[model samples]
Target: MARVAGKVALITGGASGLGLATAKLMAAEGARIVITDIQKNKGPGAAKEIGGDTLFLEHDVTSEERWQQVVVETEKKFGKLNIVVNSAGIGTEGTIEDTSLADFRKMMAINVEGTFLGCKYGIEAMKKHSEPSSIVNISSVAGLVSGFQMCAYSASKGAVRLLSKSVALHCARAGYNIRCNSVHPAFISTPMVEAPLAAASDPEKARKRLLRMVPIGKIGEPNDIGYMILYLASEESKFVTGAEMVVDGGCTAM
Candidate 1:
């Protein structure tokens, strides 16, 4: 049997990168998927590729109204929501001194506030499910450690990490049968990072520099994180909650 058979999952930022990868994997595992993203072209295309009970909704993660609409539409189509993957995020490249208030706020609104809204509404929506559910927030290795020119990004993801734990604890204490956890990945190969890498003075050299930081000597594929997300979203992780799973190619091990 498929691991997530008969489940329904909502993944924000599912138009591309890790989010799209996870949506494909979950759908293959028998979960009905709803992919939310602002990118209209790719979002619908992804849903079509899944070719089953899947949907793509135009969404801005920081908007509370959009989140509520997603929840409503998810339930309307799937009858219940069993999993949520908060993969929508943006990154800024600047040290504290180089960072502007506008840049910092933009990162925070999309990364931090986006994650916050996902968790809040995810919990509310999951509660309606008659079965156990899971919430997986996509954080980053930067959230776990300090790095160059990633102050705002790290701070934003750090908030997601702690917020997941806090919400997990709250649900546990309340006896809500819902689990919440965060996944921290380091330099997963995705379009999100590709743009910044290409914009660097020497793109190839910059790519090499980033790869050197990973002890594993390679960048991660989208499916690497997708599979981890599947495990967390599946019934197999029934005992796990309020935890952070690091998928950083041993970057944090050093």
Candidate 2:
């Protein structure tokens, strides 16, 4: 059987990059997919690319009302909620001394509050299912390590990591038959990393500088994280919960 056969997954930030990659992969592996993103232009295209039993919705993960509606719409359409990938997040480069409260709050709203809402409503919907369900939150190596230059981004991801664990423990203790985990990745060669490099005065120099942080001698691909998310979303990872799966290329190891 396909790894996620008969499963239903709702992936946030599914318009591009890691979230899109995860949606495509999971759908290919025989899951019904509902992809949501604030990027209206790309979300439908992402869902269409999968071309089978897939849907796209415009969503703002920071909105609690939208989260509730999304869960409702997904269940109404698919009949059950089996997997959730909380991949919506924003990044900012600043230090504690200079980072504005506005910037910090924006990061927190999307990264922290967004994942919190996903877990909250996703649980409410998923617990009704008889099969095991999974919630995968995309965190970052910055959460495990201190990235002083990315103050708001790092703090937001750190909150996601711990919040995932807390949700996992809560569901497990309550006998909800659900799994929750966080994924931490760094320099995954997506738009998230490329946009900043392309904006730099010397993109090549910026790329090289970023590569030096990884001892693996290569940057990562979107599917690198996508595959990890696939495992967490499938029953293959049934034994896994409250886990922090790191996909960085030995960056945090150093």
- What are the candidates' C-alpha RMSDs? 1.1, 0.7
Predicted candidate 2 versus true structure: per-residue lDDT over 30-50, tens digit per residue: 999999999999887888997
Candidate 1 Cα misplacement greater than 4 A, ranges: none
The Cα error of candidate 1 at residue 252, in Å, is 0.9
Best candidate per lDDT, number? 2
Location of the lowest summed lDDT over 10 successive residues in candidate 1:
121-130
Give one digit per residue, the lDDT tens place, for model 1 in 1-254.
99999899999999899999999999889999999998987887889987796899999998999999999999999888889999999877789999999899999999989888988988898887569899999999888897788989999999889999999999999899899999999888899888889999999999999898899999899999999999999999999999999998999999
TM-score of predicted structure 2: 0.99
Question: Model 2, which residues run further than 4 Å from truth?
Answer: none
Alpha-carbon local distance difference test for all models: 0.91, 0.94
Q: What is the lDDT of residue 167 in candidate 1?
A: 91
Instruction: TM-score for candidate 1, please give it.
Output: 0.97
